[model samples]
Structure formats: C-alpha cells, structure tokens
Target: MTPSTTHAQHPVGSGFTPASTVDDVLEGIDLTGKNVIITGGHSGLGLVATRALAKAGARVTIGSRDTDRAEQAVSGIGDVEVRQLDLLQPDSIDAFVARYLDSGRPLHILINNAGFPGLGGIVRDARGYEAQFAANHLGHFQLTLGLYPALRAAGGARVVTTTSGAQRVSDILWDDPHFTTGRYDPGLAYPQSKTANVLFTVELDRRWAADGIRAYAPHPGIVPATAFNRSVGEEAQRAMGLIDASGEPVIDPDRGKKTPEQGAATIVFAATSPLLADIGGVYLNNSDISPLDEDPRPVDLTDPDTEVPVDVVPHSIDPRSARRLWELSERLIKSPSA
Candidate 1:
C-alpha cells in the first residue's frame, strides 16, 4: 500500500487544545488488550505517558537504561512493567529487543521517547558516532527495526517518536555528522538528532505502510520540567534565557511550558487518535497536525530571543534526505568499534 498522504497541517479540530490533558485524548477509547513499549518512561514526559496509557487499559512496559529506577518510578503509576534498554549501547538495544521478542507478544505501540540531555560538549559512542545522534536517532532506529517482527505480528501498529521544535533549527550535518573536522557542539548535535527523528518518521512511514505500520513524530511542546538542563548546567539554561541572572528559572508567559499531563497529550493523540488512522508520517504539536513549513529559515539555538520553532523544517521532511539518513543510520549501526 502506498503511504497515506494529507495535503496540509492544520488543527483537525481534535477537540483537544494545547491545554488538553492525556485523559482528554483518551476519552472513550479503550485499549484493553493492546501492548505498548515506551522508552525513557522512568521520568519526564515518558513516565507520565506510561501512567496514562496503563490507566487506559494498555499493557505498558517502561524501557530504560536504569531498570531499577524505572521500576521504582512506575511502581505506583498504574500497572506498568519494566525492561532494560540503554540507548547509548547497541548491545543493550539488541538485548532489549531480544527479550521483548522472546515474550511472543504483538507490539501495538512503540514510543521512542528516550533522549540524552545536552551535555554541552561532544560525546561519541563506541562506534565513533555522535552520542546524541546515536542515542536519540540510531539507537531508536535499530530498536524499531529489530522489533519489526513484533510490530508486523500485531497486524497494525503505531510508532510515535518524540521529536521537538528544535528540529526546525538544524539538518543532519551529513558531511561531518560526528564533527570530526567540524566544530563539535552538543547544541547543534541535539537539534540534528531531532531532525533525524522527523526524517526517520517520514522514511519509516514510506517503507512500512504496506506492513500496517504507521509512524508519527510529535513535539510534546515546551516541557521545561522534563528537560535536561539541570544535568547540562545553569550556564546553558541562563544562556537560553530559561534562567535569570540570579540563577532562577525565568517564567516567561510567552514561552508557555506544558504540565506533564499536557506534555503527554500530543504523544497519546498521535498514537491512538482515530483522527490519524489514515494519516502517517505527519509531525504534530499541541495535539494537532502541524503545518508544513512555508518559511524554512533555521532558528538559532543559542540566541536568547530565539524560541524553538515548532513547524517541521523543510529539510527534515525532504524525501531524499530522509532516505539518505535511513541508509546512514544502518551503516552506523553495523560499524565495528575500534
């Protein structure tokens, strides 16, 4: 089957607004027997999404690098199970996939929501790929492909990757993806990974629609509570105007931050909405399909006045680039680390 297409991105009048909660998106929908795997469900938006889905009757598994932390986090957040997955390690991803496949369960939903906080410097994986790209893009790429059998067995499935408005600011940095000759900046690496998320959805949808798999990339909105700034440093936050000169977080009403429930709403919407049954590979925000970029200008990540652009950048959804990214990811996954 050819990939389903929608002409433009506008509010579908999803009846759920930017302020809608996860409960709002899930209203009247019963996932009773469905099975879902949410990576990074230990905290932030992923943890909350797990809670909502589990409460709605889906069998939820929280895949994390720290299984103990994940298990403890979700111990009271409905009946969520836990699995081990370190997205930074290919072996860890393989082990996680193998365990899931061994269970003989169909994967109704796969949420690739785990990500690295900006470390403000370059970190490389064993394979010499940029760590952010490896964890946020390549790891999920390998995991999704490894779980293909489970996804196919379900007969129909939805894959939702948590992309960001940051995607609008960057491209793949294809010529020097690992920054060998180019200057290394985690700020650049971070958005580049987000761009990969968008392209991955586009290419995955094109290749797997016939197999009954549909993919979505949703921006969970400006979720400060779930952000990695604390781990990165106050200077980075201060630089972004997220913190004041006194080292206090700036609460700018113009930069509205979503509550955890509100943050998870778009993810739930993308995964379960009947509104999107016929749509695949569309980027979403505020629980609505996002408009394609009419203006493709890149946003500067370091500018205090600059906000993360929510619209899909033109290059992010470019078919040719998406295909190239998919191939690039495959090679990176297969490379032998010296």
Candidate 2:
C-alpha cells in the first residue's frame, strides 16, 4: 500500500451499480450516535445526502453560507442543524471549525460537498486566489486541519470530498493555479480544482490513516438538476445531452447522468460502507472504487455520443504530486496574498 502503488485504485465490486440510489447503498447501515458535518448540505445532492444520513440516525450538521436558508431547507429533516460557513473566506472556515470543536463532539464524518463551478467568469476570493480552488480545495483543507482533534477523538472517522469526473481532464496548473499569468478559462479552472480534491484525499489518507482517520474522493456522476449544471445554461446543457429538446433532464445512470439520489449513492457509501474499512486514498464513482484510467484522450463535451472519462487518472492520484499539493496548500492558506 505504498503511495506509488495506485493507492488501491482497483474496484472492490461492491455489488452496486451506477443506478443505485442513496437508499440502496445505505440499506442496512445504522449510524446511531454518529456526528457528521456536510458542507453545502442544504441543496442539490448535498440536501439529498443530508436527509438520507439523518434518516439513518446520524446527527448531521450542515455548513452553508446562509444559515437561514439552510435551516429552512432542512426543516422537517430530523437531527440536522445548520451553521454559517463561507468556504471562500478563511476566517469563516476557521470560525465554523471552532464552533463545532467547542461542542466537544467527535466528528465521525466530514463531507466536503460544497463547490463553485467557476462557470461564467473569473472570480477571486479576498486572498486573490481563484475562487474555485480557494473554496473547493483550500477552504476544506483548513477546515479538516482545524477539526483534527475532533476526528481523532472519534477513534475512526472518514472524510469524503465530492469531486467530479472533470478531474480526468486536468491536473494542477502548477505554475499559475490562480490564472495570474495566462488568460483565464473557466473550463480549465473547474477541472483543476476537482483534481485538487482527489489529490487532497490521497495526501490526507497518507498523513492521517494511522490516526484512524481515512479519506475518500467520490465523483458523484453528473446530475443536471444540481446548481452546478444549471449554471452552465440550458442551451449548453442540451448541447452536452444533459437535457432534452424540451429541457427536461436526461436520466441515464450508465452514461453518468443521474438523479440526485443516484448521484449521492457513492458519497454516503464512501462515508459509511464497511466494505471500504481497509481501503483509503482511492477515487470512487458509481458507488464503487473507480479503476485507474491513464488514457490521454481529451474530454469532448459537444458530442452527446461520447462518454466522459471519470475514472482516476495518474495525475490526480500520484503520491508525489499529492504530497506536493499538501505542502502547497499549507503555504497558500498561511499566506495573506496567496
């Protein structure tokens, strides 16, 4: 299980398929007394996962930028609460972590589910870092580090980060992650951040596995109903076959388009599955570990017939790059202008 050896990238044949819903993966699992925190748990797949986890008896806490909206969204969902967390703001992330830790509760699961697609144009946080990279990767990095004590206190914890199939398309733009030097492309920025998510998982597992805390990155298949896809605009979505001529969502699990429930299956599976009790640092898709696919073919979004490659690529799972990313993230979060 050395870092260079694929990090157990092969599938374990979990007996689940792309069509499996959240309920399917959580069939007999009981999460009594478990304390979980999910970012962006008020909407889209996050909302679906929050309801399902709460139904399974886990006390779920949601981190959202708007507490009022979050509370309203989770209304009637038992054993769930919401707190303010703006991932693009470093102070906000720290404050959220502090509030949770002060409660003296052990964190059984942490889902880094919130993300920014960087759809229309370039947006930067106060630190001038790219918004997608800042929020999706660095913000979660800080929160996880802040919650280290609570995770260790739980004795065994799992951290699941919601990545995307887009990770296959790009690695880190090592020279200029924030688009400081080159022309900004939203397409490249989003994929770079998603790739960071998987690399972060790989490095986190390597550093924390001995502490009884394991990490996973789940590529919840494309769900057109999510705000992520909606931000792409209806015309573009239809062009990509995510929606039909009449604008209804295209539901094809085998081809990666899925309902919200189906999209969340792998997320909760990574969080609670006993099947992965011995595995960590791998990318998951369709409710199972994804096999390594190193093919260099570029993704084609315009062709509806071409299937997007979502498997783990070498750049996203490379041990050396993972370690380097960990160090780079540490530096970026510490510096005021980074």
Candidate 3:
C-alpha cells in the first residue's frame, strides 16, 4: 500500500467476530516460542489478553506503575511476570526499556494497552505535557521507539495499540499540546490521545515496513464495565446508558457495549491472526477492519458538546497528521536533563 493509501476497516475473513472470546480467537493457534509484553496486563481487557497469550505458550510480561497492585490482582495466575513501568516518568520509562534490552530477549509482540480514562482535568507530566497525551500517547511513543532493537531482532514483530472509537472526537492540539488555552476536559484529552495512537501506528508502519515491524490500533469497544470506567463514576455512567441506576450494567447490543472477553477478542485477533500478516497500520473493531468515518458524528452527551468516537476519524489516520505527530512525539519524549 502507498503512504497515501488510507485503508478502510474491511474484514479479512478471519473467521472471528466481535462476540468472539479470547479462547475462541486463539483456538488451533500456537504461540509456544513467542514473547510478548503488555502494559497494564493485570486488569480489564489487558488481563484477559495476557492470560490468553500465556495459555497459548507465549512468555508474557506485564508492566505496571504499581507492581504490587498488579501482583496482587494476578496472585493466582501462574507464569506471568510483572515489572515497574511508570509511563508518566521519563526515568522510569528509560529504566524499563534498558532492563528489557539488557535481557537480550527478542520481543515479538508489544501491546500498549495501559491508558487512563478521560474524565479528569488536565494533569501535566514532568515536561508539562498533558497527562492523557503524555501517558497514553507520548509514553507509548517513547517505549516503542526505545524497543526498536528488540522488535527488529524478532524480524516480524507486531505492536498493537488499544485505541478507542473516541479517535474521531478531537485532533492533536499541535500549538498547545499541554492545553495551554486552559480549557481542559476528559472528553477532549482522551480522544486526542486515542487519535495519536492510530496516527502513530500509521507512521510507524510506513517507516518500518521493510524492517518487518507492523502496527495496529484497535478499539476494544464500549465495554459495559472495567476499572477504567471509574473515571466517570456511577451517575455519569447511568446517564451515558452504560449502566442502570441500580448499579447493574446495561447490556446494549446496538451501542456496542461488550463484556471484557468480547472486547478483548479484537486485540488478540489483531495480534495473532495470520490474515493480518500482510496488513498493517489499519484501525479495527469487531475483530475485523472498521470502515473509515469520512464524516464524523459527534455524540452530544453533555452541554459543552463532547464528541464521542463512533469510528476512526479521517484526521486521526491521515498520513500528514501521522507524520507530523511522529516528528512532534520524537521531540516531546526527550528528557530535559539529557
């Protein structure tokens, strides 16, 4: 595909659907010698994916800002390892990367699955970058860049980024990435980071295709419940139609609300499916490719006009924007003391 070729989400006939479970996708597939790393792999969809991959015989490593929390969450789970990786801190990210490099392990799959919910006001990183953008986008950007050698050693590694349907909501605020204008909302910051996820994959694939490193950005769907949703609290979730006032999750088929397993199917599929071996830099949903949203439809949930993502926005996956974000990310992730 050409650099300008914007691929739409077209199913590759992978024989899997949105409702497929992690086991369903991994059936008949073997990953005995493969090695993988997933951040935040002890909870939510990340945990589900971690278990599935380990069950398939892959050596799985989980990175968490709170190693104790991660360890406690997976106390009964066998064969998975957890390490310290605070994405918001430059030193922590560097140390984590250096540790992995020194181990001389060939990383076959890297999943940037950890992210914060977009429900808080702007929280800046040490460099003053907005927290959502810094952690969700810039952090992953730095880690991916740092792990290039291990990815290259694998000769055909895959990087799967967990983006959201929210990518359609906002474009990267290039002039003021830190929300310098001071009007911050979880609604805006979250989508900007998600958009970066998609764009980063695009440019990464374009530049690294020859080296056999492919990348993908997939929305895990509107999961009915996950620890990540705590950002919205009970009242807001009730109003958003995610749950009832009685505290039970509302199972809505049309709105794409899914269980954690079902939501995780697409991520595992994107990571392990043979159908995608030749495909890279595509946006996914339902364990298949999703159609591009040429025209964005904003979900008016609140008075200030917050746009929730229903599809991949054109701007988020645009070649120009992807390249621009790549350059900006390279500059932003550098440590001041360096």
Candidate 4:
C-alpha cells in the first residue's frame, strides 16, 4: 500500500455481488480487535452499517447527536459502545475524542455516515450559516480532523465518508456559501453539501495517503424510505416519485427500494474490504471504482449513465479536483485544530 503505488483502473471484482447485503459483504471477514467509529450510527443506513461491522467482531462505537437514541439503537446491536457526540458542536467533538483517548483504544476505522438534506425551508445554525452546508460538510470536517491522531495511531485505518449522487448539482459556492444575497434554495443547498463530501474525501486521501491514511467517499445509492429521506416533505417526495397519493411512501420499508442492510453494503465494503487496500481517493458504488465522467454534466438529469448498471451510481474520481477541494476546505473551515 505504498502511496505512490497505483493499481489498474479496472474494477475490483467483489465476492458479494450488487444484491449482496451488508452481512453478505462481511460474511467471513473477522474484525475482532479492530476499533471502529460511525457517526449517525443510531438510525437509517447508519444503524444497518453499525450492525454489519459489529457482527464481524469489530468493537464499534456509535457516535450520535442524541444520547438516548444512540443508547436505544446500540442496545441489541452486538457488542457496541455508544458515545454522545454532535458533529455540529466543536465542544462535543472534543469531548468524544477525549473520552476515546482516555480509553487508550487504537481507532482502526472511521465512517463519516451522517448527513442532512435541506428540504423544508432555509434553516441556519446559530452562526447564521445554512444548516445543510454546516451540518453535512463542516461538521464532519471538524470531526475527522479532531480524530486524526487516533486514526494516525492505528497506522492503516480507513476513513469512509458518505457521498451522494446529488453532488452533481453544484460545487461549493465559495463566494456566496451562506446564500446571503440570493434566495435560499433547498435543492441546490443539498447538492452543494454532497459535492463537498466527494471533494473532502479527494483532498483527504491525497494528503493522508503518504501516512497510510487512505480516504474513500462513496455513493451509497438511494434510500427513499429511511431517516435520510425524512427531511424531504410530501412535495419533495412526490417530485422524486418516492411517495404515493395517500402520502405513504411508495417504497416498502423492508423489501422495496434498498433495505437498510443493502444500503450499507458499499459503506462496509469501502471501510474494510481488502480489495481496496491499494485504492485511495476514489469514488465507489457497490464496492467498485466508478467512472469520473459517467454523468457528463455535474448534475445531469438526462438518463444517468449507469456505468456498472447496479443499484449504486457512478461518480467522478478526479485527483486534481480532490486536491483543489482539500485546499479550499481547509481555508474555509479554518479550525485552529485542523
């Protein structure tokens, strides 16, 4: 896994096919003695992800904004440690790190899995920043850097950030990030945040690869019936055709769309798959490296180019853009800690 060593661009064939569930991906992979942390591991895809990793014998720590929810979710999910953490609050991030540090456990994996979609209306943090951008991008940025030491200590841990196809909508609006001058648009805001996710991974992988800290950002495909979709109301759901006339979601909770187990497969793959031992800074779907221009347009709406033709979507994995985005994000977040 030398930083300069590059593997062929061909897709890494996964044993667990497209229809594979999280458990399928981790069937015989024993993760005993490994310490893993997953943000937003209490609900939706996060919960499913936690279950898979934990079942594989990994010591999982579920970090959440809500302590009660975290406790409830982890209660029967194998041997899991629940810690109260809010990516939005720097102090909470600091506290979570301190507690983990005090425990003297070497962190082996970090999955930045939480995200928010700006749907209902324009919401801002107390700092007057748009909530989606702050929560989805800034929050995880802060948390990752804060936990860098633990990741470094493990020497070869992987950092998997949850990215979305929505990234095609827009890159960060650097000059008007807060939407101060123009009207606030939820649609644009969500896509912008997702784009940041991809760029963040690109930058992080570029810089950290030298130190054995490879980063991956993955498009976990669509979750039309999870907490991730809860933010979008009836109108947005209808527009996406995810809901029915009665206001009930058209997709079944368990079998329809991707089940939570299936939704978490790629995330699990990206985090622990040996297939990616030499892969860094790439965008993945269904455990395979994807084409950089499959979609052509940043947010192309015309039939999406299904490069691999699976539930997972394709994405750009440009190294140069990743480097540039990394620099820009460092400047923007500008945390003294980073």
Give the candidate number with the greatest TM-score: 2
Question: For candidate 2, lDDT tens digit of each residue in 1-338?
Answer: 44346468889999999999999999999999999999999999999999999999999999999999999999999899999999999999999999999999999999999998787779999999999999999999999999999999999999999999888778999999999999998888999999999999999999999999999999999999898898889988988888999999999999999999999999999999999999998899999999988565776666768888788888899888899999999999999554
Q: Model 4 residue 273 lDDT?
A: 86
- RMSD (CA, Å), candidate 1 to true, equals 3.1
Question: Candidate 3 regions off by >4 Å?
Answer: 1-5, 299-309, 335-338
What is the C-alpha lDDT profile of model 3 across 186-285, one tens digit per residue? 7788888999999999899999979999999988888878888745888877777778778887655345777888888889988998888999988888
| Tens digits of per-residue lDDT for model 4, 3-84 | 1234223566775554667887787799998999999988888888988888889999988888897898779888898898
lDDT of each: 0.84, 0.93, 0.84, 0.74
- Writing each residue's lDDT as its tens digit, candidate 1 over 1-338 gives 11123333555777777788899999998898999999998798998889889989999988898888788888877668998898988899999999999999999999999988647577887777788888999999999999999999999999999999888778999888888888898768989999999899988998998999999999987655555545657776667666678876564433545777887899999989999987888789888898877576655766666765677757778878888999888888988441
Candidate achieving higher TM-score, 2 or 3: 2
Question: Which pairs clash (backbone N, Cα, C closer than 3 Å) in model 2?
Answer: none
Worst 10 residues of 1 by lDDT: 1-10
How far in Å is the alpha carbon of 184 misplaced in model 3?
A: 2.0
Candidate order (TM-score): 2, 3, 1, 4
TM-score per candidate: 0.90, 0.97, 0.93, 0.85
Among these predictions, the greatest lDDT belongs to 2
